[model samples]
Each structure stands twice: as structure tokens, then as C-alpha cells.
Target: LAKEGEEGAVPGPDLVAAMAEQFAESANNVIIEEVNKGLNPGMIVLLVVATTLLLFFVGNYALYLYAQKTLPPKKKKPVSKKKLKREKLKQGVSAPGE
Candidate 1:
């Protein structure tokens, strides 16, 4: 079903943050329940480490993508005609147009 009016609008940062917090809380509760239900300690450690590394890599890649999109392109510094002419003159080379 489609949402109507303000309900269909994009969620702002505050709403997004709250939703994320709530989701995290629920995830934590689930983890805690699994621990209480005799989840292996080694399994928990592995899961934590794997999740951290995955998130780190994904976040790093996302930042690289954002930087690529928002940053300006590298510019080249061209040699000016005046500088080129001076260099040529210092080398005893005469200008063709002169």
C-alpha cells in the first residue's frame, strides 16, 4: 500500500537516527537472548569480529565513493606561453613567429 501526504515524505536525520537506535536495541535484545539460551562464547566473539570488519570495509568503501562524487577533479598546470618563450630564449632558441 502507498503512503499518503506527510507519511510518504522522506525521514529526516532525527527520525532516521531514532529508527536506527530502535533497531540496534532490538538486535541487542536478540543477541542477549541467544547468549542466555547458551550461545557459544567463541561463536559470539567470531560474530562480533566478523560484523565489525564487514562494517568497517563497507563504511570505508562508502566514504571513498562519497569523496569521489563530491570532490573536484584534479587539475593540470599547463606551461604558460611566457614561461615557454623564456625557456626557449635562455636556450638560444629563436621563436618561429618572430
Candidate 2:
């Protein structure tokens, strides 16, 4: 039931649901239908390839994250004199001036 935005429209019949019902009622007792019930060679190969690639990428990313957490911190770089002087000035260590 569509709530009152009223293009004065009744809900249209769902064609997809109608099609699915028609297909489900199909009595196509073909021998090929029985073959599709089991996994095909192409589908098995695709599944194996997909699973392998997924594991490889996920394992690599997991190892990278593990290394990030477990590895020692990098050495600190030396601060430049300009930044140091600015910091000192901010801390009110001024030179002798008006």
C-alpha cells in the first residue's frame, strides 16, 4: 500500500514476481536440468580461482597490518631551527626588545 503521496496511483503488478512464478511453474523436465544440479567444471574452477585470489589479498593486507602493529617506531627526524625558534617565541622566551 503506497502511503498518501497520491499520483492517484494504485500499486502496479510486479512483472518480475509474475515472471518468477511462471518460471517456477515450468515443467521443463529436460535431462540438462539434472546436469545443472551438480557443480560444473567451469564453476568449480572459478570458485577455486576466486577463493585463492581472495585469500592472497586478505593474507597480504593482514600481514601488513600485523607488521605495522608489531614493528618498532621509526627514528624521530631533527626539528629545524625556524620551527624551534617559533615554538620558543610561543612559550614567551622573547629577545630584549620593546
After superposition, candidate 2 runs with Cα above 4 Å error: 1-33, 36-45, 65-70, 95-98
Q: CA lDDT, every prediction? A: 0.87, 0.80
Worst 10 residues of 1 by lDDT: 28-37
Clashing pairs in model 1, backbone N/Cα/C closer than 3 A: none
Q: What does candidate 1's lDDT look like per residue over 1-98, in tens digits?
A: 34434566776788889999999889867643334667789999999999999999999999999999999999999999999999999999996699
* Clash-forming residue pairs, model 2: none
Candidate No. with top TM-score: 2
Model 1, TM vs. native: 0.41
TM-score, cand. 2: 0.44
lDDT of 2 by residue, 1-98 (tens): 55545675564468558877788778564456344568889999999999999999999999999999999999999998778778878899973352
Quote the lDDT for 89 in model 2: 89
